[model samples]
Target: MAAEIRLSPCLNDNFGYLVHDASTGATAAIDAPDAAPIRDTLQREGWTLTDILLTHHHGDHVGGVAALKEAYGCRVVAPHDRTAALPLVDLRVAQGDVVKVGSLLARVLETPGHTLDHVVYVFDDDKVVFTGDTLFSLGCGRLFEGSYPMMWDSLLKLRALPDDMLMYCGHEYTAANVKFALTIEPTNPALLARAAEVTELRSAGQPTIPVRLGVEKSANVFLRADDPAVAAGVRLKGADPIAVFTELRERKNKF
Candidate 1:
């Protein structure tokens, strides 16, 4: 059976995802930046919310869990740390746990960089991943709690995934991310083409999310830290991948 996904904008720039398993009608909201959109999306589609899957403990991500649970009686799944501030978690998953979203199964990858409790969901059969603030199109999340090494390791986990995976991140920062990426590897034609496409998409008032991982694998600066061209751009020509990644991330933070 195929899985269905719905993308909606929440808060000012954050994104909310609604995924459903067609065979079982098991619907889930990946993260609840705001309740109104998630609530309305489920209502508008007439799909019962069965689960609220959290990627981190950030308020923007978990803020709507309580209201949605009260409205739909959905079970909540989240990482097993810093969850005291979140609503009661029905399942506290660690790395390598398989979560059933209806008939679909999602494997959890603990990716702590933006936040200490960050995790991304990979539904292998569906060729989709829900990356809540871990990785974005042409960029990665800002380091707020974890260190450069931790974030670097987390990114490698994402990099090793199949190239066909479609990434659905937590925010609408593609245009900005692409801009900063150009400063890192301005000579990359793939990045240039992608940036142009993103510019056009945003100009048309379209959402530039659920980006292709294949494209990101080549264009995202954070994901290409080992590339000689990228290392050269940062003036770290023969540096280690971790060091290059560290420099790239710091440059982006200041970019």
Candidate 2:
């Protein structure tokens, strides 16, 4: 049986994924930035919204929870650590928790960096991961509520996943991120080729996300933790790997 996963563009460039278990006819919305688009997509697909899986507590990521729940009465599953702040979380889940969407089971990964309560959903069977803001296409999220070391550790955890894992990120920021990657790894053939592809895709007004983990490992400067060139470029007058990662993120923040 085929597992159906549909993408619906929500607020600005944010994407909300509708993952359906074709075998069981169960559907779950990854994040609800806006209710209208999600509702429209559900209606269009004739899919019932059974669950709302939230990766983080950002308003743009969870803003439509109340509205969508009111309309569909779906269970809202969010990180247990931030339940006090999360407005409508019905199930407070953490690492090791398994969320079901139809016949698919997503294992929760507590990846804190963009936010202290951020989590990623890994569908092992499908080899797909929904990386909210912790891990982006070619770049990672800015250090907002977390520290550099924390972000680095979180990224390390994600980097351990299978190289072929499909990464579904939060936004359409790959083109701009590739531009920054080129600045750091100007001569990297993989980066150059990926940049060209992203440029062409953006020129056609298409989304440049859902990049593979292997592609990111080869082209993404942030994911190249041991690359000598990246290490040298990000190294301060006197810094270690963590420091290099921090400096690199700082440079990207300004870029």
Highest TM-score against the true fold, candidate: 1
TM-scores for all candidates? 0.97, 0.95
Off by over 4 Å in 1: 82-84
Candidate 1 residue pairs in clash (backbone atoms < 3 Å):
none
Write one digit per residue (lDDT tens) for candidate 1, span 78-163.
99885446676999998999999888999999999898889999999999999899899998999999998899899999999989
> Clash number for every model?
0, 0
TM-score of 1: 0.97
What overall lDDT goes with each candidate model?
Answer: 0.90, 0.86
Off by over 4 Å in 2: 235-239
| lDDT of candidate 2 over 48-110, digit per residue (tens) | 899999998889999899999999889999998854367678898888999887779999999
